[model samples]
Target: MRLLHHSTSTDRPFHLDPAPLVRWVYVGRFSIATAIFVAAVLVWQDALTDTGKLLVASLAFAATLAVTAVSVVYSEFYGRALGPTFHYLQSVFDLFLVTAVVHVTGASSSQFAALYILVIATSSLLLPVGGGLLVAALGNVLYVADALWSVETPFTATVWVQLAVFAAVALGSAWLSAKLREAGKGTEAVLAHVRLQAADILYNIRSGIITVDATGRLLYANPMAEQLLGLDLDPYVGRPVLEALRRIAPELVDAVDRSMRDRVRTARAEGVISAIGRRFPIGVTTTYTEGDGRNTDRTTTAIFQDISDQKRIETLRLRAERLEGVAELSASLAHEIKNPLASIRSACEQLSRSTFTGADERTLTHLVMRESDRLSRLLTEFLDFARVRVARREPIDVAELAAGAVRLALAHPDRPADVSVVCEAPHGEFIVEGDDDLLHRALFNLLLNAVQVSSEGGEVRVEVEDASVKQLDVGPNFADGGVALSVVDTGPGIAPEIRDRLFDPFFTTKPGGSGLGLAVVHRATDVHRGHVFLDTGPTGTRFTIVLPRAARTMPRFTLGTSSATVLT
Candidate 1:
């Protein structure tokens, strides 16, 4: 591959150094010099030894070596200190060397005469336009002068043919060089544009991408990678960053290392990242590319993304499926048992009212009826969870709902007297389109749960936020505009082992808990195309309900028909 150097000077906005190619030219020149001297000594030794032609050949060989040594040192070590003139000098030196070879072998009939064409073509590519033709004319003069001055040299048509060939080759190669140079500039422009586009895409994407070479040098890290990993990666670029990467995202570093070691690609793999004491799931993918023999380096690229929302959505989807099936079965069982339960209660009541009833018989019948009443209440909760749906799409003010729910939840008999509830709704009206009754019930359930879990004198805060107006880390699932209702409590948080089952029907932690509250919350939000998020730790538990798309106007509670009570 050819490397380009950008020039800043207006006199030469661009410069292409032919030093690499020139080095190759030196090799070819040395090989030709060696072959010519060897043939003169081994093949034509006696014929020219006494005539002094062999001595001339020896001097020519010595001059070739001396000129080449100086050219290599000047071009390679000095590094374009003399600019294009340095290249011009090399081309002229090559022409003179070829002329000496033509003189020693045979002036007009020399087989080594074609060496002049080689020098002409090399100078055409190495120098600017007209440089090749300039060298070509000088070579013709040297060749003709040698032929005229030599005693044994014969003037022939071959001399004229050789000169014509040199001129034609010079013109054709120079034109080709000019075209190639123009194409290179156009290609460089296109490459620069493509590089900008790729960089923009990498930095702006939601996922994190990192590229690392086999020796642990960080090749690239995009902006999202820096944010997700919670580190400033710009300074570590083109340097070893594996030590820094290991603290927060060791899994990501390992993925790249495995790819580099195995020379393979991994797709849709699982990884984890932690920052600021919060660890979350991330989906990882990795791939490796082996460098060409010219460069001994292998690169591995790792791409990962925070998948908390995806995992939450998947869990909710699975829980919904399980609850729906359970709800249907519960409804069927309740319907079949309700009829017989009522008959049994009726028979026990009738038996108690008869004259034959003793005190023991009346007590048993009362106990039977009370137990039946409790089971009936439990069945009703099951039906409510199963039948959750958005009965009306009306713009109901959520801030009003939260205030009402907070008041009622705080007043419940289950709440401790000293435990306080604070409702904070920032905007005047945070409106969402859903069944007002369902939204209210779900909001109340979350608040009541928080209140119940709080210690005496602890705080339970209910906040209503318009996510469109606020920047919140609600994950990608709820990235769109929403009205987020958060119920936070200062209680011992829910356990990780039980978090997955928090929304399952009849799953509870209390002594006499009927665990359909969170189930109803999940089902209600699902029907409204919203999401319910649960974040619990040792400090406290936070339950967030995000209802997608807050409404612009209230359809059910219009100002003309009725005055909407934003707060009471």
Candidate 2:
């Protein structure tokens, strides 16, 4: 059988494969009626004239055959007309054919005349007022013509009464037809509005949408699909769903197809898609459903969303976690090694003080003591590196803190005479809220790192400027607000590769370095809800520490001179 084409104007077209069972019912009824009419003519042959009986038999046979052929043809061909208008035309033809059969038999007191009323009522459900009226007029004229010319019976009061009933049925059917047409128009308007709204929503959404039929043919693809898949939306309709998935990633096609075939209602996959030769992470969610009400089989829809930034953040978070673990380990080892280092230094100091007569003896003692002191200093740095805990918080004058650290560095007996500590700040002291001890340690570590890198006698500039503390822009946690203190050194700059992981634990360029100094500094800053940034260039590295500023009216705590001493 040929496939029927539906009219596009209807919101929903009626299309179904014709059922032979239904067709047989109508054919059987018509055949029984034809047989009955033929037997009736034979039985009345003696009572009626030959010519009259022959005419009756011929008309009965012709009406039976004509009705059967028309009914079968219409059931097969016209039922597929989708629009209300075409369906109305089909109903009209059906009514006209049924009325013609009624007219073929004698019209006066014809039992089959009632069939016209049934036809008109059924037609009213599908046809417009104009078509209904036209069909009714034609039926009425045929009824009148048959009544006037038929010889089988004379017009009776019953015939007149039936005609009145037929007229009333036609008029009422036409009015009902007009009402149905109006309702159909209203429904179309509502459906059209809904479709437009849905289109707009799909077009503007951030995620891409793709809908495919049971056969895996793409039915609809929105603008976002075009953007995410790097494919043209218009040309993709009716294409295989796998084709679009291939544009995103070949793996995606296989995943979706497998899920759909397995009747998976919901599934998600994350993968990278190459666009312009660069791979970007994308997340896809596929949803499957059988068509509504009809159980027309399953259809799958996939929504694509770009998640490259999210993946990058996840990677950074993992790296940060690993660094944290390393920081903890380094802190523990440093604590374990510090005690023995102090003992070695004391022993070497005692040896250096012992009496020695020759110049060579004095030089050898000096070298041994100097090297031991250096080892002691290295042990001290290791201890500092291993201790990454944040101290109790209090209000602190950053300038005074810097001054105190500089004083301690200057008072060292082995300090180079050429090294100078220069402090630049406005008249008002910049105050921040943090653990005083932790802040002090952080500042000292920064200064020491600066001093280590700088040439002997080189100037290490310390600037205390008011800087607002804010949250990290691209991290899991962010600080509220704080102050910043910068210690800039005129020393060899850090290399680029090391700069990325500068604050990472156990990442140090110095020989015998435990790499916990900056890590501790980072942890301290974090506990204070602050941030630390390193700016390195050809000139030197500048470590900027930002801590939340203390309220001006808050009470301050003072640590005595002995209390302020650094832990050995």
Candidate 3:
């Protein structure tokens, strides 16, 4: 994986630095001066050369060197203001100077004509593509004018051929320079695009990304990191990461610090962070970036993700597996104890009826009977939790079920008279396909729980409605439609410590409670492929059961409402 820090600068293929070119101008001035002196010496020594041609050649060289010296001074003093236009102006002046010297020294045949090529080539580097070609055209025109002026009569084909040669050289230099510039631009563009793509991957990726410098200062943090850590990151950049996250996400900085100090190239850790009034389980992976295999300039990059949902699902799965094992054991144990329990109850009843027994003996027998009955009830509850079955299924009205459960709960002899229970079915009817007995049992448990939790004079409301209208997320199974049954109690909410294990068998908070009511409710709903959710707060607690609606067309299984096949 290639890691990249964010950068704001745009890439450029070529940045024309004027310093080197200006230096080159000075070097060329010196070299040309030396060449001119040598040429002047050669011309003056040759007797064949006339005085006029020698003077013109020497004067032209002197003029060219003087112009170069002036340009060097101008560029050094005010180069920023002139930019590259100074080089261009010098190229134009050199063209005219070379033309003048060539015209004086023998026009078409002057070897000094080669000087125009140098002017055109240098101009191409300082100017744009069009400007380079324009300079080439200007050089061609000057060469033609020199050729025509040098001849006293009509021009020969040789002079025209020389003009053509000069034109070709000028055009060739301009074309080659433009190609070089474009090639540089293309290379830089490719590099820029690759850099942009890398930046996008770093910024837009799903995982949280954070980079801290060698001193544990935050260098870069992506948007996901800001959200996952729940911190205002804009203010914290370039600050110490440990200090920024000290109150909420200290573990993250600690992990990064450990990775930076360790010998390992990479480190991994998991922990819970409390931020924004919530806790999140995050998995962190820290990568240590080394600089020159030394401790200096080291960087630590941490990637993290929220794993709270994953951990909760894992816990639920583990609990389900454990409950399955317990159910298997309870089924065997219940069968083993049922017969002995029955014999004990029968013997106690027989002893209580005997006339020979005194009042104390009768009282002892009654006590034995009462204790045995309590044991029987406890065993029955254990059996109910251990073995849950749905042997029959049919379309039943959920509103009717809600009404029956509410009426039964309110009429119970143990129910508090000051508590009011009400049923609401605004739609009047909703159908769900499930075993009638099992559904009834699930609703009864929920209703009973609400009534028990309610304070005196408090209301317990049982609501039956369409789950789709409420927009409850009942998972993929109930995509078409479903019915919802909720039992709400106006009582103090469940304690946070007990909420997680609220549905576990044999787990209870109340004295002498069997602890299997919610467990049985969970099993009954599971057999029908239903979902249950709890909404608990300081105000009250609401238990909602969602079961998918029955299909319009009947299924292959036979419907039965009269009998239930007990699983145990």
The candidate maximizing TM-score is: 2
* True-vs-predicted CA distance for residue 113, candidate 1, Å: 1.2
lDDT of 3 by residue, 1-568 (tens): 2223433344533534557765775676457545655665665465235566566656767777787778767767655444556667867776777676666656777677777777777777677667777787888888888787765434567667766766676677667777887786777677778878977897788888888777767778888888888886776576666776767766676677667765335556666678877998887778888887644368888898898888899889979987886786577556545765776676666676775458757676666676677678878888777678888888898888888888899788767899899998985447888889888998898888788889878999998766643332324344235676888998898877788788776677787777788888888887787877777888788888878776442122222221211111
Ranking according to TM-score, highest score first = 2, 1, 3
Clash pairs for candidate 1: none
Error of 2 at 556 (Å): 66
Best by lDDT: 1
Residue-pair clashes, model 3: 1
- Give per-residue lDDT, candidate 3, residue 503: 79
What residue pairs are clashing in model 2? 331-386, 418-457, 469-482, 482-547, 482-548, 483-547
lDDT of 2 at 166: 71
Off by over 4 Å in 2: 1-80, 83-89, 103-106, 180-192, 233-236, 275-278, 292-297, 332-568
| Cα lDDT of model 1 by residue, 1-568, tens digit | 0002232322332335676778888898787778777877888866355456676667767877897888888877766454668778888878877887788778888888999998888888877777778988898888888888778877778889999999998998889888887876676676667766766687689988888877787777777888788888877776788988888887677667656765664333566788986889888878788888322268888888999999999999989977887786577566656775776776677676676547867666776777677677777887898789888888778888888888888678988889899999875657778899998899888888888888878999998876532212233223224676889999999877888778766778987667789888888887877777676778788887777655233112111221111110
Model 2 TM: 0.48
Error of 1 at 195 (Å): 3.9
Computed on alpha carbons, the lDDT of every model, listed in order, comes to: 0.74, 0.63, 0.71
List residue ranges in candidate 3 displaced over 4 A: 1-324, 327-357, 468-474, 551-568
The candidate with the higher TM-score, 2 or 3, is: 2
